[model samples]
Target: MRNASDLPPEAAEASASGVERRARWLLVLLAGLLVASAAYLLYARGVFEPTQTLVLVADDAEGVSVGMDLTFSGFPIGRVRRIELGGDGYARILVDVARRDAHWLRESSVFTMERGLVGGTRLRAYTGVLEGPLLPDGAQRQVLRGDALADLPRMVNAARELLEQLKAMTDPDAPLNASLREVRQLLQKANGRDGVLGVLMGNEADRTRVTAALDDVRRLLQRLQGVADRADALVQRTDQRVFGAQGLADDVQASAREARDLLVGLRATLQRVDGVLAEVHGIAVNTRSATQDLDALRVEVEATLRRVDGMILDIQRRWPFSRDAEVKLP
Candidate 1:
């Protein structure tokens, strides 16, 4: 456990050299760790991965800068690599999208650069259809710029114009004011005389119209009362005629009884007539059977001829008329 001062100069020098070597090794290790950390950070940021280039043209690049992220659904899919002035005088923004994340972008994808009043600008991508065709490498596309405070001046101008219009409408000499004054006058009249009825009939000169209408209503009520009284009397008379002891109902019942008796008599008479008709039909049949004497009938017909000849002779004697039916000519 001797002190280093008691050691030989060679051994002391060798110990010093070994200490120096160790210190140098520690410093080199620290440098290597720093470099490794830096490389890991770059790799996490996707610096080492191969990327596709996209060109975005815009009228303005107010808040856009290099190294800004182009995000889709809040995920960093691409980055703004550079911004340059194009030959057409527009700002041409260059974006670098990594190969893995670039699949989210399609041919129909839309890009926007939005600047807000409260925050820095954001570059965003929107893909309408994930199944659409892929965006080609080095595709030149347009970036739509949107500003949250862009329409503020126009809106203020519109508000000022509307205020002027409202002021004009409220002016003393405006027709709208005249109409409002007339309405106020009408509201005042609504509280007077016949109340709102007078207002409905019209102004001061037409106040009597409401009074006349009231009089007509009174007359109509009186007439209706008279009509009701008359109708009540008529109903009483009708009740007496229909239901009283000496009423038309009693007379109708008596007539109905007489008619029933007459109908019974008529039916009995028709029965008797029907019996007589039956007897006549029987007699006709008997007579037809008894008159089956054809030879006797011919003999009677001869006898009738002789009688008729005698009658003719008597008629000739009595009348002194011509028996000859022949005519003589000169």
Candidate 2:
């Protein structure tokens, strides 16, 4: 409550109170601004709203950072929150996707980081099927990595090998040169009067031999064709003799008439056979009755034989005949 000018000289010289007051106001203002800025950043990052967390595991986290934007179809939808090394030696990137944008990520979605040869790397999200189920919270997915720089070495090696092979093949002193010389010789031979045949056979004597062989083959082919023609003519003649209208038909008609007469004779014979069969049936009935009587007689005879056998055994036992001797009946 003291006046401003009534302060001590030493305190005035130091200007301690004024400096302390200014510092307090400045701190308060800074604190307020920091809070406001944090709130704005949280809103911008979609942290104030509900979100789902997704983890993307990658072999290398090269160009990614926290709070980096995650774009979907060229639209920003999420941001990376944290990156940690998992126990399995992979980097796990935690991303917070807003609820509204979460629908864009399905279970079938794939994440990839495509690195260009001359430009910055890109983090792309690919949802192959829009009708698939939505990705659940805390989903762990593997991120595919593509690097143009990584494949350059292998491509260069393969190209270098291909170029070396081409160089060897095109060399003037290579085996290909010998083949070219042979081709030139063949072309020159083709322009000669002997033509390609002379080039292949190498001389007139060999060419004459080949020509003779060809003539023999032509003659053989002509003979074969003539034989085939004669065989076809013979087949036609056989068909005319065996199955033509005037040939087999006439024989068939004659045979049919003979068969008709035979059938008429067979009918008359069948009448006589029917009378004989009637007599045979009557005899068969009588034979059946006689067979029954013979069966009864056979049974009686068997019984009599058994009785006689017993009497013979008794007689033999009373006489005490030798085992090998056959007794004669008195």
Task: Score every model by TM-score.
Answer: 0.61, 0.54
Compose the digit string of candidate 2's lDDT tens values, residues 1-330. 886589888868679778989999999999999999999997876778898898999999988888777788988777889999999999999988899989999999999878888977667788989999999999999999999989999999999999999999899988998899989989998999999889889999999999999999999999999999999999999889878878887798889999999999999999999999999999998799789899999999999999988888877777765784355667
Off by over 4 Å in 2: 1-49, 55-59, 65-68, 71-76, 81-94, 104-110, 126-142, 187-192, 199-203, 241-245, 259-330
lDDT of each: 0.91, 0.90
Query: What are the per-residue Cα lDDT tens digits for candidate 1 across 1-330?
Result: 998999999999999999999999999999999999999999998899999999999999878889999999999999899999999999999999999988999999999999887999999999999999999899999998888889889989999999999999999999999999999998998877668877786775587776788899999999999999999999999999988878999999999999999999999999999999999999989888767786689899999999977777766667645677433334
For candidate 2, the TM-score is 0.54
Model 1, stretches more than 4 Å misplaced? 1-12, 169-179, 214-330
Native-to-model Cα distance after best TM-score fit, residue 305 in candidate 1, in Å: 31
RMSD per candidate (Å) reads 13.7, 22.2
Q: Residue pairs in steric clash, candidate 2?
A: none
Clash pairs for candidate 1: none
